[model samples]
Target: MSRDGTSASRNAPLVGTLLVLGYCVINSTKSVFEGSLVQHLSPEFIAFNSFVLAQGFYFMICRDKAALLATVRRCLPDVIALNVATMVSWVAVLYAFTVFEPAMANSVILGLVPSITIALGFKLRPGVRALRLEVVAALGMLAAMSFLVAAAWNGSSAIGDLPKDDLAAGLIYCVLTSFALSAITYFTRRLGDQGMSVQQMMASRFGVLILVTLGLLIGRDSFDAYTPRNIGAILLISIVGVIVSLYLLQAGMVRTEPITVSMLFGTNLIITYVVQFLDPRLHQSTTTFVGVLVLSAAMCLGAWARWRDGRDNPPAGVPDKVPAEVPAEAEGTTQNVGNRT
Candidate 1:
């Protein structure tokens, strides 16, 4: 009994680490393309592309359309909240880049997300406990993040480094962006709260994001900006940056500790950290290591918590132990869909 418990406990952090590392590689794979696309592509296009791809994947992978449609319909209201939040995060991040250095802006804005996720995770699961082992792991990763930050300082040249004013601006942007993401995570968790499956939640997030961003694009007069270069960027953004990135992320969310991986996701900041060495013209900072360390520690802690909490996660197709008040229609639809699948 003791050995089994020890093994499971050990597996918890391993799962969490792998989850973050996987996403790091996924997001990093296209980081080069991502920065340029963000500059050139319309927000609406990016949002639309990602959401469509996400939904396409969801619909294809879902075993049952009945349940999918039912959950989507039932969960639509909550998804709007998520879409708005994410839309804001996207816009702010782009704008932040204008005023702050990308690395600095990413460090603060992206770093805040993990902390927000951890906070929201607990808000969603009030009964979840904090574990000591996870805390140690968080510390270790934080030390690593510090190394990365230092590595960044020691590392890049092409990226922006936030000056005092830029740092201030970055913080302001990061805080708001963090708030927006809190909503994204919170509402998605609420979708889960409403008895929607992962498929339903991912589908709704994509569908709503696409619709909303498309509407915004039309209104913002961003249509005339399209050139062949922009068109290809949007397509690439959709296929690699948006769809593939989101698919990997959502899958990670489903399979592992979301808050933990979310925290570890702070590594996304200096997307060019390691590669910038080839150029040697990129800006590097020594403090980046310390910042990375702090961020990593927080994420590892969050992952540990998520792993510990996952044990209590309701099995597939079951309500949480507390019993969410799902609508009768929702229950029927889920059952119908499950049966069909």
Candidate 2:
């Protein structure tokens, strides 16, 4: 383990870029699936797909049959929490879609993501402190929000403008979704401290979601018996969103700081909007534009914080566990969870 805060085996810059590209594709596909996939399958069935595909991929990567079950049992609780949060987030977003336009709802839902994550950070990891440059980063986030406000974004109008009751329902869904996703990020960071591979963490997380889905099927829905469309959506989600995109996230987070990773993911706001703009059928409005700018400012805040971290190390309160050199599989055996940084 190197004394530096990051893991010792710095994945090559080229490799990291490739990972980002991979995730971008996966995530973009996910954007499509989020709006479209639910029409074909039950949530329960989708969960099972995650389990099967993620598990299959994890095994293929590790190829260590002996340690797999033991590792899973060891981290079961954290994994389950992650899955719960994940399911909640998905449900919330889906509910939002039912009540709002995909573009508007997605913007607001994701626009609030970094702010929600900041709240989660304070709640979950009490010891960690925000860096001075984080203030600047925070300012950037605010700027981005301003852009969004100018855009005059409203989720309901595009979806036929729900009634007052439906609007209330939509708000609840968005909030729940945000809370769940925020917690998922916090828990994943904790799992990282455990030295688990991104693959392992994802496998365990998705694996539990599958179980939850199966449990839901006992009487909840007839999803245990999959139809062709259900099977296809689940398979696509597992393969693209969970297996491919998440590996990039895992590799990126291992190389990057947690907050930085959050910022990177937040960039999806830009990605989604740009995609919306290019789509002639997807009309943009005033409030939506305002929201984008405002959110852009917030993202800048996150970026500034990372830039500052590069100048000086992050506060030592958050212990650096995995040496940059040690592989995820080697966490328990080779690396002592000492502050290698």
Candidate 3:
């Protein structure tokens, strides 16, 4: 290779790391913004606008129309399944944000995603072996989530004066988000195995939600909600959170190791908590502090376990082993765990 080529190759990982970190920070901040927007705009309206804008952006930038169309036609069922999963996840997480603090909602959804994905992976693919460390890490995350739920139930959460009923509903929505995301990850992987690129998958994944959300908007005549301010907010989030964030993630995944990507993405929790703390509108309690700490630890442990597994069982002909639980791209929302919305 030329000297310049060698230099560029050497710096690729660093560049990729920076891009992924940028994605983490941007998505985390967008989650807080979504929470605030939900106070004025219904989750369905926000979701509808986000999907429509993202679809437009993806369609315009997509370079391989022939390849994308071939893949969609060949794997039509899987494509539909992935779109359905994305729709459910986007709606659930957005609704969850309406009731829960953005930080708390992000923490629960991102923190529990790996565990949920792992469990579902095992159930769907019985022959795959589960790592002992990964199992322990999953249990730790569950326990931490349980503690956070208990805190919310007793009204001792960092978000002050949350009604128990609303909090409970929010938590349920978070769980639903996790499940939908797991399904999204699964279907994304399946389509990948069938030769679909991340860009193609993204281009195809929003169609179902676009139709569903558009129908709801038309039925309710929610176009009145599209004031200048709301349009600006939705466009900002769709551009930064959905389009640019997922682009960064896809680019980073190509150059960086999966373990690095997992760890960097895990930092979203801290970034989110700090942003929430700075926002005067949000509240933080002692339990919230402890919960963040616990969730962070759980995330690190899970990342480490995945790293160790890759080390012990390196895939043949592959230089970097992809983390099994981290999805390569996020759709719709700004916070989709590994992909982050």
Candidate 4:
């Protein structure tokens, strides 16, 4: 790659790492408080309210209409696709949680995100290639997630005990959720590369999300489920989970490789696993502890691959920074040469 390409590539991963950490931190904190709220309201109701508040906040923070319009004009298809992915993923995950255990459903579905993102990037992303090591790292992440789920699995509970209808429906929803998340990771990087800010991408994304949620609320008659307490909780979830998390994700997407984002995003559950250990009701078995260690190792491997790739493939057009003293030195030399002349 040329200098500019090399520089961009190098910078992208660093940006991605910071943003992923931001996403993880903010979302993990929000999640700690989310369980109680979920019990009081339907997923759709909570989702709708959260986006409505988030969208409103986005408008307040993003005041430059001209730039926003230009971004929309330039990346309409991508923006729309991204919003659809967001909407679909949220709805699918919420529905899946209704039919399956939260840990089991999330583990199975989210584990697919890294692989799907890699596959999609290979097929759809021009000029972007997946390295063998990257692929292996992604698979490792999936394996680690599976192990986490296994650790949480109750030996007494069997798949046969789940109603066949609910199981099939949950599986379908889970698949959709995984594919939608894959799309989000891919498109987020695409838009970020196109020079859109996290705020701009988030504002547009939430704008669409609000509309989608509204339609769902009206169509499903879920308004009756919302209470004053749930309303407050949903607002909180929106500000932290929807707004902050999505912004960090977009910011990170702009800087990092998509696969890195996918792999790291899958690890968000690590926070939940840690929180579980604090609760007497949520016991951590020897298997769960082992799974946590494996998950940590997988994340380390994926991060290393990303770092190596960035170093190896720098972006063109970015020149090395000139020494600040060079201009002054040249001016002094020019004066001396003039005196001699």
Give the number of the best model, judged by lDDT: 3
Candidate 3, backbone clash total: 6
Stretches of candidate 2 off by over 4 Å are 1-11, 39-41, 72-76, 132-160, 217-230, 251-264, 276-282, 314-341
lDDT of 3 by residue, 1-341 (tens): 99999999999899989998998898888888888888878777888888888998787777989988987999999999988888888888888988888777876876677677777766754555556776676777777778777777777766666777898799899988888887886787678777777667777789988888888778877654567888889889888888888877777776787677777877787787777776677777778668877877776776777667767877689745354323454311112345544
Indicate the residue-level lDDT of 64 in model 3: 83
Query: Which model is ahead, 2 or 4, in terms of lDDT?
Result: 4
When 1 and 2 are scored with TM-score, the better candidate is 2
Name the candidate that leads on TM-score.
3
Score each candidate by Cα lDDT: 0.52, 0.54, 0.75, 0.60
The sequence of per-residue lDDT tens digits that candidate 2 reaches over residues 131-247 is 555544454544553453333334413243346687677667766875676676666666667765555554455555556567776767555456676677777777777666766
Cα error, residue 42 of model 2, in Å, equals: 4.0
Which RMSD values do the candidates have, in order?
9.1, 7.3, 3.5, 12.7
- Residue 298 C-alpha lDDT in model 3: 70
Per-residue alpha-carbon lDDT of model 1 for 170-240, expressed as tens digits?
A: 45665777667656655655676677765555455555556667787788867535577766666665666
Residue 66 accuracy (lDDT) in model 3: 90
Model 1 spans with C-alpha error above 4 angstroms: 1-20, 29-32, 40-45, 49-66, 114-170, 224-226, 249-272, 275-281, 305-341
- The TM-score values for the models, in the order shown, are 0.63, 0.71, 0.91, 0.72
Give lDDT: candidate 1, residue 243. 59
State the lDDT of candidate 4 residue by residue for 1-341, as single tens digits.
89999998778678778877777766644544543344445677777777778777886788897999899889999999988888888777777766554444555565565577667765767466666675776687589666644443443122224566776787777789878877776676678767776667767885565687788788977774456766667776876677667666656655654446545654555665565444333334455545555655555565566656656875687544322212110110001100000
Question: How many residue pairs clash in all the candidates, one count each?
Answer: 23, 44, 6, 15
